[model samples]
Target: MTRHEQQSRLSNVARVDSFSRDTREFVEASMRGDGCLVRVTHASVGSTDIMARRGDYLLHPFPGFVSGYDFIGIVEFIDRPAQSLGLSVGDRVAGVLPGMGAHATRLRVPSSLLVPVPDGLASEDAATLPLDGVTARHALDLLKPSPRALFINGVSGAVGLLAAQLAALDGVRVSGTASPASAALAMQYGAATFDYGDTQWPRQLLDQVGKVDGVIDHTGSRTLNSVVKRNGRIVRTAFGGPVGHQKAATAAGFAKTLVQRFAQPSEVVCSTPMYVAMKRRSYRRDLTKVLELADSGRLKPLDPVVYDVSHYREALDAAGQPASGKKVVLTFGE
Candidate 1:
């Protein structure tokens, strides 16, 4: 369905039959038989890609697959339904996929999964918003009635930073755990920061801000008992453990974290409770809201460190470094 004449190529993350490991290599890929085809300009590098590469993500696929979650691109072709939604060829767009595939040079995705990127927003900034921004929104959404105070774990992280900004916009008091290097950045987003490297950081937060009305915890369950007030809400975004471990181990760890969180007197929830079929309408709406916030300068995205698609390995390595506060992104035709 593509209007472009050139063939499509992608960095395929080929997985073993045993699902024990994966390797990346360039391969030919065709546009989806259905949906619109996008000429990908920039794609995000996230921990999900790292986890998928290691076969540790809970939804890791069998056989082999492409391994990216979000992308920004130009619409090269559109179906009637896409046209009905007001999309046109050459319109800049950004979106996240239900499964991994955005790493490639071209993508065939449903029109409902896509959102228009605002004109003033750079593609690199738009690239980081889809996955993390929606996740942060989901986390905040779980806090019914809207808590007056919020504490986010991993405040320097992609999701945590966006959550901080969104929470601040709602006039919520925000405090979070961050590395010393990222503390000032967190403060810029209206969060009081504590050094997570300190074992007593929980106490530090308690001393400075008292118990919070809610917690968006990406680290694990261990911090919940101390930071969250009794009966406060909890949104669990990540499980505690290494990313390159076995799938069984990852599931086990996730279950254990759930049990621990539920054991608390507080209300425990998950940003993504399960990996069911995606609701394209809801995803498109939330992504649109996040993009608008960024466009209006209400939610400022951190400047990402961009890399060419050819230097993907270096980008991955840089993303894994603990001290690097910036998001890593891959570009095509730059």
Candidate 2:
């Protein structure tokens, strides 16, 4: 096919079968011409993708869906409404979907969900941000009175690293828990790092860094509740547990967790990024701000472990490893 034909072609998606299955080859791509259609260049396989694959994500109850939430791509087609919103054919953009579908070679997404990728940023680097960067920024924004000292649970992870950097840039004293291998990286990003493997780590955090004004808990660990001051806030960046626990996940259970977290007398103001993103409806605004911050060199991008789209299983395996402190990005190369 000619370059023009290829650019205009429909997507070849990474379709997930049932839980814990490898992605099927491609599915037929039909255009409704209702949104901005992009030719995807890079996509990130995050923890949520792993959860969805394990049948752990509540949002992905059914199977046979495409398998990514974040991607960087060039706009191949634009609806009139999307064009009015400032998107155009040939613009390079990055975005997160409310649901799965970004892993495709082509993707149709709402123009409002995407932000223009800065010229200086590479697509691989830009691919790592949309979901995690926005989540970190939004979590920090939820802190009331703004934190003077912040504690991050799981600081070495994707979202945690970004949260640490963003908080540090705001002049907050950041401390966080990480494995021994990743502790230096956490410190390099401006957080005083501790080993989470220690059962007494919370006490260590308090004795060492002192009580924090705010906490961002990505691990869903209740132990983090001890490090925040009485008037401080907490943001729970994720939900569910292991694949076994996720099998038992329910709406009632989710509601109970929310209520229990919120009942902590203002000390724990729980906010999941996906929940907040959907509720606030400010993804485009938040994503644009983070991308601009990255472009301005205020926020450093994580160096991703890149793999071809055909090796998604291997990418997913690498991303699922606990000590893998880098983002796993899949590219659709010629």
Candidate 3:
């Protein structure tokens, strides 16, 4: 497209707004990037977007808090010295905002939070990379797994799949519980699959793949002491609440239990989305490495259930609804 064509498109840019049912307007953000504008082509509606729409995420709700985390887009503008990062206008890029705001056509991304999306990777695929991949890598970095087997509960979900594959890369044999439909795909990512459809999956896992070195629980914090060995690590990055996890952990009597949560620079967290967001600057190395693997067809890429910005409501609803593997995304800047 010519400069005139691009200019005309920018003047009519559309973006999804706050999750508040009352004030959820389709508004526009600044077209200018102050030398840092990202024209988002794909933005993922993650668990945070789903929960925020229900008005239950943040303790104090604001009127116009935009709902989203990860995004992939062409760099439309670059005001600062992004050349150091090999970034320039028209480069495809991916990023995660620590606070909400990626669910828009235009995002004013800082240089520190952005990375060039590898050539040949789809925006939808890269959109899943920043938040979930960073999360999976961060957890493994903390765990430092060695030639041991770990079971990932809820293995078919976005983060679980990434963690499963990454754990395998780090020499941990990965096993995970998934619906029978996704059990094969989970195995493709190197997890020994146990059918979650079985009401007795815990027992099934023990009988088939005895004695896990650790467990990554994404099932609303249900403890796995019944299947995990003593002194084994159980990491929770699930949704809803951790009340069930707390109860299960205490009742099951594990020697040590780890609850991964939002992290700060002064501390480290495991297996949580916020862990990636806060560590965006520090996580650049691993983030680039994973996207490289994706481009080379060596990593398990997320398949997105994409919607246009006009279907924002359906997108949010789909995001909240039960699904396996594929994440819900909103696309703009066509």
Candidate 4:
């Protein structure tokens, strides 16, 4: 069979076992045959179902009742299909996994789905790119904000923060919701921040900024009822549950809107062209801007909280804590 056919077949038949509370044991069993010992470089566990059986070809879960998604890092010792394609040791990769042990020392992954780290970027920093950065880019492409005002809900989240910055760079006037601390950070990135805690935030925004051209709702809650204009666009990223008749009725009046049921990374964001371009130059350019912002004290790299692989359970707990500012990532050889 050709490589694409082989990949198609493998994808159609890949077996995924669901892990309940014992993800470590489950990962050990999954990797028993031909697995590598990849270090868990970085991980995030929120707003996705924690456990599910993942089909082979389709990296996204079969939709049912689930809460959050899990991503993991693993050290690959043996060459696999991904290695043949260019993924390498100490490459620092990240991809969706069956569950949360990704925060541990190492986890097994199917070779084809892994994304390589861009050259000259730290794994800790690179880890933050895949899930959020790629998603933000995709969502913006979908919305196609054109020098207009954009509103981002939950701007403090990883995806939200990146989305705001990307929009601002596109010459869009950006506004976002966050706590006071996160709002301060968002301000430095060129977005006008709104204190969501204030009961009159919606009214304040309407009075201060008027109707927005597009809204990126990361919270997926219907709290935006009064803020969005009748003729504006709304693009929702959070999938709390099915959109019932009430939401359907409310959304019917909008000129253009979309509710993304899943947040999977699009193939467009992971294409060979994008990857090659990133490795050759674009990745460094964008990241250097971020780093320069950091160096100039304009942008902060999400509060530097480090965690060892062994302390993964604690790290996961820390991630769940409120107002933590980004996440506590795993550091190798520390």
lDDT of each: 0.76, 0.77, 0.68, 0.51
Model 1: per-residue lDDT, tens digit, 51-162?
7776677776464667788889999888778877789998999988776788888888788778899999999988878888988887897886789989898888888899
lDDT of 3 by residue, 187-230 (tens): 87888887777778788888888877666664444436577665
Question: Mind giving the per-residue lDDT tens digits that candidate 2 earns over 133-203?
Answer: 88888788878577999888888888889988888888888988888988988988988988888888888
Candidate topping TM-score:
2
Question: What is the RMSD, in Å, between candidate 1 and the native fold over all Cα?
Answer: 3.2
Candidate 3 clashing pairs?
A: 33-36, 33-37, 35-78, 35-79
Better of 2 and 3 by TM-score: 2
RMSD of 4: 9.0
Comparing 1 with 2 on lDDT, the higher-scoring candidate is 2
Say which prediction, candidate 2 or candidate 4, comes out ahead on lDDT.
2
Steric overlap count per candidate: 0, 0, 4, 10
> How well is each residue in 272-320 modelled by candidate 4, as lDDT tens digits?
2233233423433343344444345443445535666466556546655
Deviation from native of the Cα of residue 179 in model 1, angstroms:
1.5
Report RMSD (Å) for each prediction in the order shown: 3.2, 3.0, 5.8, 9.0
Error of 2 at 320 (Å): 1.5
- Which candidate order results from sorting by lDDT in descending order? 2, 1, 3, 4
